[model samples]
Target chain A: MLPAHLRMLARLGNGEVTMQVDGPVTQRSILDALEAQYPMLRGTIRDHVTKQRRPFVRFFACEEDLSHEPPDAPLPEAVLSGTEPFMIVGAMAGG
Target chain B: MPGVRVLVGTRKGAFVLTSDSGRKQWEVSGPHFAGWEIYHMKGSPVAPNRLYVSQSSGWFGQLIQRSDDGGATWEPVGNAFVYDGVPGTHQWYDGTQHPWEFKRVWHIEPSLTDPDVVYAGAEDAALFRSDDGGLTWQELSGLRRHTTGPSWQPGAGGMCLHTIKLDASDPNRIFVAISAAGAFRTEDGGETWRPINRGLRSQGIPDEDAEVGHCVHSIAMHPARPDVLFMQKHWDVMRSDNAGELWHEVSGNLPSDFGFPIAVHAHEPNTVYVVPIKSDSEHFPPEGKLRVYRSRTGGDEWEALTTGLPQQDCYVNVLRDAMAVDSLDSCGIYFVTTGGQVYASPDGGDTWSAIVRDLPAVLSVEVQTLP
Candidate 1:
């Protein structure tokens, strides 16, 4: 699942994007695969140079906030096995 | 009918307003890239149909959009704006040395002779140029590495290189202005630059007549005489006769001179336009009135053009890049207010009418007179 703005920007239909992760699906691996699949989403989700997640963007899966997790940490088993969709969210913050 | 296309960048999205030569009966299109901040949209001087847009967001970062068929459709171009080399530090808001960081693009200036070449002015005050249309960009780097780079600080707004003027008579010469950093001129294309701020004065700075740190709001020049320039500083209206070598106060008879966005007439190089707000702190017209002041003799003397503008109980600001003029025989002047009003003067500021009301707080406006 993705934000409405990011969905429109990536031209994805009204559904979750499923990609084939080559190896163990960590946060870094999933993000690297997603960015490789959709090049335009590179800087939108993370900084171009520092590669840090943008301040107002969050990641969630299995009904838990995984935004603060280390990039090398393994995602929830449900997210890795495709039982639960990884969610990219725009934080409920400023206007 | 010779028509005009008015490209407007607003707080929420971008809008394109089209009209026939009469400048009446406009057709407005978009909220293109809806729910995004469109900072600026500009067309190529050689190929008017080729357009470039700066689409950015706090959460999603910066993206460049390009249009080939006059903004009917757009494609995302390059978004990477990596600073050159070490990306050194400049003065931060707290008067401490902070490393330069890329935030967003404030302006996009396409080359005069090529549709494939373009320039972008970015926040944190840097310049980038793209040669292969908009596919990639490289920083000029010399401007940021100037000797006075450490002393530059942000104005009320973030430190942004918001103005880029390419001299038509000499392709190698280009001029750019930054908030609180004053103006700079490059003689050998983008290789070498020097601060050209001799005669400008600002009260708040340590030295009133320092080389940099004047906080230039906007700058304008007529293509016919690129040597002469008009500037709307943070408080005063200024003019330079020798290609920005020395500036002099031209605030003369205006009720107030603290405003953004100054423009020159399309055909008459001697005529100029400025919207004077009350003061630096209060960014609105004086006496609760909205007026567009015109000077037929270039600078000192000015006349308030409020025939169709509101003369009472109006408090809205015209931002630094919101005013633009079209090159029609009759000469059309257009500007957008923070109140979401886009006003047009079809006959050279003699009278005015709102082209459209209730937009998303326009950030910039540019006009293209189409054949």
Candidate 2:
């Protein structure tokens, strides 16, 4: 799942997008695959140079906040197994 | 019939306003990129149908959008703005050295003769150029690497290179202005730059007459006479007679000299426009009157244009990039205010009317006179 704005930018019709990761399902691998599939989303979710998640962006999988997890850490088994969708969220700030 | 298309960048999104040569009725189509902040959008002079936009957000970062068929459709282009070599540091607000970081694009200037070449002025005070339209960008590091770079500090706003003026007469020359850093001129394209702030004086800085410490709010030049330039500094309205080699005060007879945007008449190089605010501390108009000061003699003497403009209880401010001029026979002038009103003066500055009464506090406005 992606934020409405990012989904609109990437021209995704559905809120949730499924991508094929070549290797183990980690945050870095999923993000790398996402960027490769949607070039327009580059630097939107993470910094181009630092690859750090933007301050106002969060990641969630299996109903748990995974934004603070290491980029290379493995995602939840539910997310890897496609039972649960990985979510990229725009934080609840700004009126 | 010839027509005009007004590109408006506001706090929330961008709006494109079109009107026939009569300049009476307008068709407003907008709120594109609905939730993002559109800093600036401008059409190319050579190819009026081609447009470039700086769409950014605090959460998602910067993105460049280009339109090949006017404002009908847009595609995201290059957003990466990596500085050249080792990005150095500049003086922060507290006088401590702060490392340079890419913030956002504040302005975009398309090539005068080519639709694909463009320039972007960015926050943290850097210039980037793209030759293949907006797909790729490369920093023109000469301006930020000046000898006085370390001493350059941000104004109340972050250190933003918010103005870029291309000389139509001489492609080799380009001018850019940064708040609290004064103005600079580049004669050898963007490879090298020199401070062109000779006669400017800013009391806020340690040296009132330093070469590169004056806070230049905005700068304007008439393409027919590129050597002559006009500036709206933090506190004074100024004019440069010889391509910014030197400048002098032209704030005579105005109720207040402090202003934001400055623009020149499309046909009359001698006519200039400025919207004076009360002071740097208070950005509203003087006496709650939203009037545009016009100087027919190129400055030193100004007249208050208030017909159709609010004269009482108005406190909205005009931003540095919110005023622009069109080259139609009547020479239309347009400006947007923080109160979310976009005003148009179809016949010079003699009269005015609001194109749109309510917008999201316009950030910038650009006009294209189409054939």
Candidate 3:
């Protein structure tokens, strides 16, 4: 079990969805929880085999772009402490 | 034949080019969608008069404009496909919250089997399909719906779907390349897709499975032999004969392996073409030389074609969709670089000539024969 007030930002199709997560989450745990909640989000975040980040999905916490951070890397203390929001943004471009 | 019509899509607008007798004289048309950025312009193969342009207006939103009168006038597909977001929800992508928000449509390809069916690859790593020409669209969420765990992270370009290749022989069999996810294939149309990144190479993975994150920029299939495919990967050029089941690097002979576009001669399936560029460190044409290489033996041997190109230092970046080979018997190979120059090789890349220069950054070029 985790804290009840931790918020997450899941960006999709040029829009962001901020949802509440109840746990101490690493990149892997956050995505696992997301997939369990929204089954449609299964393969949307990482590579199927290597479990590495896809080119388009970016994660951020407290103004920091955590996209390239390690999968199991610990989230910011503020994000874990339920004091700040973690954002997942979609990076869109025409070219 | 009157001449070849070149549809040029740019960062700003769309342009049309009509040539005279010897392919010497060219009349260039409008920067249609003037202030907007046109990422893709696809002329309907089934209907010569129909043209589709995908544009993104900074702070104005993204749109798919259709032109029935060639490149003269345009109209949007309506409000149905607009990104409105959930009602009353002040989400980040909420159009009402961020009034100027829109997703960029990076690539668009009309269905070979169904002319009205059009598919678009977006920056969000999602696929949108339009059944009635370019009127309305529906997101194919299946590609984003199957990841079971957390390892699925988006790469540098975001989780984007850059290229979509549908089999002309079997429209149901489709292939899509994601920037970091490698390549995916689907036999049952868009109902389901499977990652086919077995033999490619990526940056983060171990040497044994480096093929996973190879960052596939573009892929070309031998029209006659669908199983034979060529990929312009981030670090190397590779070929897969078993329809991506396995891949082997064939970029040894080229001066550099870092490039974006790859095209196979329409008539001669064994023949393919690639514009090589210096690696990430240099990131330019090899030794300041602008050349196109043709591999007639399926990457076994390559010949540099520079008949009428600049003889001196030439440093230009040719985008993936900027270079294409026509489907004619003799075949016409064309390429546009970031330097606003267009080159055409009518002799199957054996000889080259400049078609036009001093235009906007050439994002994409498609050649169509006019009746």
Candidate with more favorable, higher lDDT: 1 or 2: 2
Candidate 2 displacement at residue B18 in angstroms: 0.3
In candidate 1 chain B, where is summed lDDT lowest over 10 consecutive residues?
B200-209
Model 3 lDDT tens row, B1-371: 64577888776677887674356677889777665667778877777667787776443345677777777776565213322232121112222322212247878887765667889887655677899987667767666554511234345555457788888788788888876657878888887887777777665566657433447888999667989889998778899998788888888688778788899987888888999988775656887889888899889588888888775788778887887776555678888887878888777888888777777787888777666
Classified by CAPRI criteria, candidate 2 counts as high
Candidate 1: tens digits of C-alpha lDDT, residues B187-206:
99998899989899888887
Write the number of the candidate with greater DockQ, choosing between 1 and 3: 1
Let me know the DockQ for model 1. 0.82
Error of 1 at B28 (Å): 0.2
Instruction: Give TM per candidate.
Output: 0.99, 0.99, 0.73
- Order of models, best lDDT first: 2, 1, 3
Give per-residue lDDT, candidate 3, residue B25: 73
Better by TM-score, candidate 3 or 2: 2
Worst 10 residues of 2 chain B by lDDT: B202-211
Cα lDDT of model 2 by residue, B126-175, tens digit: 99999999999999999999999998988888899999999998998999
Summed backbone clashes in each candidate are: 1, 0, 30
TM-score of the A chain in candidate 1?
0.95
List where candidate 3 sits over 4 angstroms from the true fold. Answer: A1-95, B20-22, B78-102, B148-156, B210-212
